[model samples]
Structures are given as structure tokens and as C-alpha cells.
Target: MTVGRVGKEILEEADFNKFRQALIEELVRKISRGGCYGADIRQIIEETLREEEFVNFANKLAKIIEKRTNISKESSNEAACQLVEEEIADDIKGILHGQLEERKGKSKKEKEIDFMGRESKLWDETTKRFIGKKHGLKDIALILKEHRLMKITIVTGFILLIISAFLFNSIYKAIVVGLTLTIFSGDSLRIKLANVLGGLGGILIFFTSISILLQYALLEERRSMELKEMARDYLEKAKRKENFN
Candidate 1:
């Protein structure tokens, strides 16, 4: 199935209205960043029109000119406000300025910036626990024991599992690493570290899985037995596990 997008709906026309909408979109971006409300955007648009067109019109042009599909009326206001702020026409006199749709999708650098915000939102959305949803002690304990129910320990345990996978050369270890990271992406580290760790943990899981499976397959039974015996031979190395980074 193809994913649908907005903003492109206005592309049917290649006129002044289109330029206004494009200008509005840029304005919207700036206003959004500053947390400016629609009123602020409208005020800016009004000032721009009054100065350039020699008229003080409200510029309700977005709502009037286009159907509000992906664009909100408030968003239109923001977009118009943003248009004037960026110096599109420099003077907005008789000269015409046209802004094309940059792309159907956000540029990769824009997407990267957007991704960090989304990743932040993911953390922010997880902040509070719902008390009523909390079950009894027995239920909680049983939930903790299940492989599928790793909502909490996965954070630190994921890192540990990564380290553990290298030591064991087992697919089980890699699966455990992935499962742990997924369960606790919202948690696990300071918010900043959590973002880095969450992404890294995902990468670690995939590569570690392949590394583990191949390492296991390559080792013959006799070699495996010898490795285990050799591991057991050293007391100091007993507790510390090797890393798979």
C-alpha cells in the first residue's frame, strides 16, 4: 500500500495562491519552532500585507483558497507568518516569488532532525505510570518471569545481554539482547543516553545475532567442549564476560 501525504494537494495550481501557500508553510515552520500561536502568525501576515499591498487585510487566504486536508487553519496562519519572516520577496512589491514543493518527503537531514524530536517524544510519552493498571504483587512477579514480559529490566540487561552474547556465542543470547532493548527503549539511561543506547542496541542486536549464529555453527563439538573447559580453567576470568562491540 502507498502512503498518502498532504501539502501536495495544493499543487494543482501554479499561481500566486500556490506561492502564498508555500510561503505560509515556511512561516508555519518558524512559528512552530517558536511555539507561536495562530494569532501571532495572523498578526505577522496582516502586517506584511498592510505594508506591501497597502491594505490591512486579515489574510484568511489559506482557509478561503484551499480545503484543509493536512493543513489546519491555525497551520495556515503559522505558514503565512513564516513566509514574511524569511524575506521571500525582500520587499513583496510587484515582483513575483514562487516556492516549489521541496520534495514529497522531508530531506534526509531534515528527517534526521525530525527523528531526534520523535525519539524525544517517545521518551516524553513514557513519563508517568498508570496506577490503576498496576496489578498485585503476585501478578507482577509472574509477569517478570516471562520471556515476553520484559518491560523493565531490559534497559541495563540489554547492554549486559550484548556483552553476554559475545561470551556465549549463542543465538539465545542475541535474541535476549534484542528483546530486552525493545522492552525498555523508553527507559535504560539518562534521556540523552537512552536515545543513543536505544539506537545502538538495535544495531548491536542485528550484527550480534549474525555473529553469534555463525560463530556457533563454525565451532565443532570438540572445539566447543575445549573452549568451555578452557573458560573454566581460569578463576579470574570466570565472572567477567567478553563484549561483542
Candidate 2:
């Protein structure tokens, strides 16, 4: 979608309007309170803008834009940031500058320098939080647990264990290992050793199956992460290309 189209949609969003108004009102209240230095005022403004509700609104906007335009989330997020900077930040900076002027009556040169510095800082923080933030990767274990291949591997492994138990007659050995070592107390040393080795071999087969499955799961998860990063990078490049055009 064109930048103007996205901007128009952002302007029409009710939540965006509410967020913008609330931000301005909060900033005005905080700035009007006496005794805040310029830095303190900037900090207050930045902290307020970064509040959970405001950040959530930005995220929500980005998701909506992504869904509507079929744009990459990163590009949609940039669009969201642009909307916020244009619709909310300019008004905030204007109010702040006016407040500073009233409070200090500073020379124009001094006021201009301070204003530029604060503006730079605010934008830097906003850009970092809004556009540069990343979503956390899905939990590999949880994801793999529900994976079709992983489930098959687990069931197959269990079946192999049962088959091994029957083939090697290691069920008693397994019971001995699981419940009590004293099950074969009256047996000869050779018998005990044979049972132990047979049981261990069966267990090893099951564990080897599990290990292979885990390795496959990890590789799949890593590949998924790489694909996501590549997509984000592609989107970022596309955004840059769009801007250049």
C-alpha cells in the first residue's frame, strides 16, 4: 500500500485518536507540574509514551496495517511509527517548547539548541521502541512437541521399545530396573549381568530414537528462525526501495 493510504487509515482509527489525545493530555499535565528541568521533562514524556497501553496500541496498529495491506510486519511497524511521529509527536514538541519558553524566558539561541536536543532524544527513543523492537521467537520445545513429525517420532519410539521388550524378553529386566534391583536377588551373577545389559540395550534404542527426533526438532526450529529473519530483512530492504522510489 502507498504511504498516504496507510496514513489516512491511521488517522481514521479510533484507538489512534484516543492514544494521541491521551498522550497530549498526559504530557501537558506532567509538564505543567512545577520544578522539572528540560531533561526531566523529556524523560517524563518518553516514559509516558512508552507505557504499556501506548505500546500495545502501536503494536495493534501495526498488526492491522499488516493484515490490511499484506505488508511485512516490519514495514507496517514503520508505517505505524510514521503515523505516531506526525500525528502526536509534533504537537507534543510544540507544547513542550511553549512551556519551556514560558518557564525560562531563555534566549532564542539557547531555547533552539535545547529544543533540538530534546527532539533528537525523543525521536531516537521512539524509533528504538516502536520500529526496532522485535517479537520473541516461539518456544522451540513447545513448538516441537506439537509438530507432526515429532509426534510420529515419539510414538514410533514407544512402539520400538515395546517391540524390543518382546523380542529380547527384557520386560522383567525393565521391571527390575524400574522397581527393584532385588528382583533377581537369588539369581547368579551371570544372569543378573545378562538381564542388566539386555535392559540397557532396549533403553538405549528408545533413547537413540528420542535423540534423533530432538536433533531434527532443533534443526527445524533454527530453520524457522532463520526464515523469519530473512523475511524481516527482505521487508526492510523493500521498505527502503519504496522510499527511494
Candidate 3:
């Protein structure tokens, strides 16, 4: 799609609000799940809002709420105006209750630390629950391990591309090879980019790769059409020859 059309669609306020509402509803549903904890809720919110569309909607909604509620932009205590907290108060309470119940068998000190960890900040408290001290490190390791194969593939592909470019002594050929590799490796690129640069950046890379692939597809399509026309001409000539015979 053209930039102008994308801009127009993104700027539509009604659509933006609709997306925001949908996002809010999804968060509520996730939070209300049985055995759901504050950490899970935070994860849900972070992953959902990571999308460019959702992020844009959130920023717009926050500004609108600030204006409507007369909350000063300079005020640091605007968490109360947050869409999730405002719209899903009961659901949040339920989630908190579930979390509390889950911790029933733990020692008082453990429970206190967990509560204090979450109470440090509203959103932070909700997501920063006690999953054990080593949980944080394990989470990081798991994330890296998940993308280990993709990283290896990307490195191997680039090395091969570089070697081929050197052997052929043609930068143009290398570029075409690189684009082809990128087009086919779109999923790996998206996941890596999102993990490294966040959701919006990943999306940008994904679309850029798709655009390049589309160009390649268009070129092939044109070539196919030309070949079909040529075959049609050859068949016509052969038919005329047969009739003449």
C-alpha cells in the first residue's frame, strides 16, 4: 500500500479507538483467567501493546484521557487514569486475589517480599511478582535459547552470501542473493528484530522485506506473461502451417 493510504488509515480516530477498546477487552480476559498472577497480566499487556498499532492507540488514548480528566501532563501520578486499571478494576482485584491465594503455602517473609516487590509501583508491582530469584535469569536464558537456531541460520546465510559475492566478484549479484535470503528468512528476521529492537522496529523490517519480495514476484509475473504470449504466438503460427499443409 502507498504511504498516503497507510497514513490515512492510521489517522482515523474511530478505528484507533476501536482497536484500543479491543485491546483493553483482551487484557481483561487474560487477567481474569483462573490462577492468573500479576506477572502474567503484565506480560499480557506488554506483548499486546508492543504492536505499533496498539502503541499508537495507547498514546492517543492516554492523551485523550488526560485531557478529559484534567490530569496535567506534568503529573507523575497518572497511573490511575490508565485504561486497564480504570476499565478492569474488578478483574484486577480478582487477579490479585488469585495471586494471593496461590501464595498461601509460602512463608510470611516470602509473601511480604512478594507484596513489597509488587507494591514498589503499580504496574511494576503487578508484573514483578515473586517467580523465584533465579526466575529472571532463567527467563532471559530461555528467550535467547528460543532464537538460537535462527541466529545460527542468519549468521551462516550471511557468511555464505559474502563468500559467493567474493567468488563472483559482483556486488550486484551479492545484493540480489542477500535480498532473496532475506525474503525467505522473513520469519527469523521478524523474531530477531522484535527481540532486539522492540515490536515497531520488527514490524518495519518485516514490511520492508515483504515489499522487496513483492517486487521480485512482480518481475517473475511479468516474465511469465511475456513467455505465455510468445508460446501463444508460436502455437498460432503452427496452426496456420498445419492448415496450409
**Strongest candidate by lDDT:** 2
TM-score of each: 0.19, 0.30, 0.25
Model 1 lDDT per residue over 1-245, tens place? 01112222322222335455434433333322332111222344444455534222225435432243343454444333332332232222111121111122444543443333233221111111110122235443444454242434444546755554444354464454445553323343443344344445655455544544454334333333433333233322322432322
Candidate 3 lDDT over residue span 1-245, tens digit each: 01123223332532554664456445544433422212333345655565675776556644543444344454312322233432343443342332211123444543443343233222232222221122334543443355565445444545555554554455455555454433222355433432323222334334544554564445445433443344344445555887999
Better of 1 and 2 by TM-score: 2
The runs of at least 3 residues in candidate 3 whose Cα sits more than 4 Å from the true structure, single-residue gaps closed, are: 1-17, 24-47, 74-81, 91-245
Candidate 3 TM-score, C-alpha based: 0.25
lDDT of each: 0.35, 0.48, 0.40
Clashing pairs in 3: 118-125
* Candidate with the larger lDDT of 2 and 3: 2
Q: What overall lDDT, based on C-alpha atoms, would model 2 receive against the true structure?
A: 0.48
Ranking by TM-score: 2, 3, 1
Native-to-model Cα distance after best TM-score fit, residue 162 in candidate 1, in Å: 3.1
Task: Give the higher-TM-score candidate: 2 or 3.
Answer: 2
| lDDT value, residue 18 of candidate 1 | 41
Q: How far is candidate 2 from the true structure (C-alpha RMSD, Å)?
A: 19.8
Query: Counting only residues 3 or more apart in sequence or on different chains, how many pairs clash (N, Cα, C under 3 Å) in candidate 3?
Result: 1
